[model samples]
Target: MSALATVHVVVPARNEERLIGRCLDALATSRALLLAERPTLAVRVTVVLDGCVDGTAAVVRRAPGVDAVHVTELSAGGARAAGVARARDLEPDLDRGRTWVACTDADSVVPAEWLVGQVLAAEQGAVCRVGAVHPELGPAERLLHLGWLARHSHAEGHPHVYGANLGFSLAAYEHVGGFAPLACGEDVDLVQRIRAAGLAVVSTGDDPVRTSARRSSRVRGGFADYLTALAVDLARAT
Candidate 1:
C-alpha cells in the first residue's frame, strides 16, 4: 500500500558477538510492537559487522529477523553509512520521504516499543527522535549509572541524541549527510548538525535502550570516568 510507511533499523557492530545476539533479539521484539501498533509500518533490521573477528555475522543470520552485512573495515561511522546505504538499496520501493531509519549500537538492547515509539514521533512530525540509553548493569553499578544519568540528564537541550538510540526519517538522515567518516563522536556531531540545520530533535525518555556498563567498569573510573570520557569528547557539541 502506498500509504504504508517503512522503518529500517541499522546496527553497527564491532567484536560484539556476545551481545549482538541480544540486540537482535530486542529488535525482533521491537518488530512485534511496531506491527501491532502500526500495521502499515514495514520493518527491517540490518546488522553491520564492523570488521569483527568473531562470529558476529553468524549470530545475526541466526537471529530470527535480521539481515546481516559484514563490513571488512572496522569503523563505526563508516559501518553505519554502509548499513544505511544498503537498506535503501535493498528496499528500492521505500519512500525516502516517509521512510524512517533507527540506529543503535550492536551492544545495546532496545526496548520492545522502541521502533513503535520512534514511528509515533515521526508521524507527529519529529525530524529527529532521541531516546534514552539506560545502563544495563548490576544493582550497585546501575545505582551509580542512575546517579550519573540524573546529574547529566539535564544536558538534553538540543540535538543531544546518543547514537545508541537515535532515529530519523530517510530524508532527514540524508539531509544531515548520514554518518560521517569520523573516528569518534560522529553521533554527537551529526545530531549537532541536524540542530544547526534547523531540524527538531525530540527526546523520548520513555523508550529506553539498554547498554552495557562494561566500559565504565573497565575505567576503574566508574560511571564518573565513563561520563567524563564521553563528556570530554561530546560536551562542546552537546
Candidate 2:
C-alpha cells in the first residue's frame, strides 16, 4: 500500500460559465466527504480558466475554497498542466509519491465519493486510477444517449481514459513528464504514457462522473464532438 497524503483536483475550462458553478459545487461536496472520512487528509481544487471570454472566471471567483487560474490559451492539456503547477506552487512541500492529482472538466460533476475513491485507490498501491463518466443528455437526445451506452462499457477493467474522471500520483505524473500540450486527446495520451512506464493503472466503473452531453464542444475532438460523431453514425445506420 502506498502512503497517501494530499489530493489535488485540476479542472480545465474554456467558456464553461454556464456549467462550471455546478461542477465546483459537486467538487466541494466530494472534498467535504473526503475530509469527513479522513480528518487529517488535505484536498485542493483548482479550476484553470483557459482562454475564456465569458463569465467562467466570475463563477470560479464566487466559489469558496476553490482556486482559479486564468490563462490565454485554449489547450485543454496545457490548462491541466498549469492547474497542477499552481497546486504545487500553493503547497511547495507536497510529497510527489504521497500526493494525488485528479483531473476533470469544468462541464463535469463528480460524485461525493470521487475523491474518497481515488484516495482509497492510492492507499491500495495504485499509481493511477481511471474511472468512468456518464453524459447528462437532454430528453430530446434520448436515442443518442442510449446508443452511446450500447456502444460503451461501464464496467470495471473497461478500456476508457477520460480526463473528466482520472487521478494519478504526483510522483507518477512527474515521472511521465506530465500532460502534453495537446488541444485534445490529452487524457488518453497521458494514460498511454503511464502504462508504458510500467505503472499500475486501475480502471473502475464506480461512481461515474456526470458530464455535459452538448453537441457543441469548447475544444475540437473532445467528448462533445465524439458524441456528435456517434449521433451522426447512428443516424446513418437508421
The global C-alpha lDDT for each of the candidates, from Candidate 1 onward, is 0.76, 0.90
Which predicted model would earn the best TM-score?
2
Which digits, one per residue and each the tens of the lDDT, describe model 2 over residues 43-123?
889998888899999999999999888888857788899998987899898788888999888889999999999998899
Backbone clashes in model 2, listed as residue pairs: none
Q: Write candidate 1's Cα lDDT for 152-214 as tens digits.
A: 463344324577888887887888788887666667777778878988678767677888766
